[model samples]
Target: MPGRSPRRSTPQPATCRTCWGGSDSGPAFDAYATAWEADAKTLTDALHELADKIRASKGAYGGSDGLVSTQAARVRVGDGTVSTMPAYAERPSALASY
Candidate 1:
């Protein structure tokens, strides 16, 4: 007995049921349900807010890309045979040496 550890008893289902007021329709169940619902709503609202931010960022990136493309289209570099000219103007070749 001096070298032996004390044994611990595990609670049965009845013991657990009794602790929660003995049935499903109890104060403990009601409190748990209310807290769960509140937590779910808070999570849903945060997700929606995050989605809106992502959409706005996507639109901003798209607009910036369009503006850059438009500006790039207006720039032109000359080939060795001619002086520099706008991209919209006619040139001997589409490629430039410098």
Candidate 2:
């Protein structure tokens, strides 16, 4: 035992049956469903906000004109520059495929 290393226990998987349609999933599923709805709402709200910002930027610059440049144009979003245009545009149905 002096030279032997201590054995580590196997880590348990962080999972809930109720959330993923397993046995005894009633209460767990309910709780997870509530949280899922809240998350979905938050994502939708954030996407809407981004869309509004893009629209405002379009008005300030010109529609599609500001996005296009002789050289590579980068749009600033917060502290970072996004090198693409359509990324800021809103497509509500885009997440529907998921």
Candidate 3:
């Protein structure tokens, strides 16, 4: 990021001549980004499908309990102290829904 090239450089030229003649580079960049976006979107869709299949086929360790529950505790070790956030418990009233 430090040495990144600025978006626009050179005197008030209408276009960059490196990609296209007459110093115009907008079209080249736009085309490249369009193709890249399409490819990335395709890969993202595939990954999502794989994740969904795995999720659907998951056993008891699915998302329902994937998150570990914890109870509040005070801990100290080697003169160091740390406070941890304990997981919340379902209120007694909520059990009636089962």
Give me the candidate number with maximum lDDT. 1
Instruction: Report the error of model 2 at residue 94, Å.
Output: 64
> Can you give the lDDT of residue 27 in candidate 2?
68
Pairs that clash in candidate 2: none
Q: How accurate locally is residue 63 in candidate 3, as Cα lDDT from 0 to 100?
A: 47
Decoy 1 TM-score against native = 0.48
Scanning candidate 1 in windows of ten residues, the lowest lDDT window is: 77-86
lDDT minimum window of 10 residues, candidate 3: 67-76
Candidate 1 lDDT for residue 46:
100
RMSD, every candidate, angstroms: 13.3, 25.0, 20.8
Model 1 stretches astray by more than 4 angstroms: 1-25, 73-98
Whole-model lDDT values for every prediction: 0.82, 0.73, 0.67
Q: Each model's TM-score?
A: 0.48, 0.41, 0.39
**Candidate 3: what lDDT?**
0.67
Please give, for residues 45-84, the per-residue lDDT of candidate 2 as tens digits: 9999999999899787774564577334554466676566
- The true-versus-predicted C-alpha distance at residue 10 of model 2, in Å, is 40
- lDDT, model 3, position 66: 44
Residue-by-residue lDDT tens digits, candidate 3, 32-56: 8999999999999999999998877
Judged by whole-model lDDT over C-alpha atoms, candidate 2 comes out at 0.73
Q: Rank the candidates by lDDT, best first.
A: 1, 2, 3
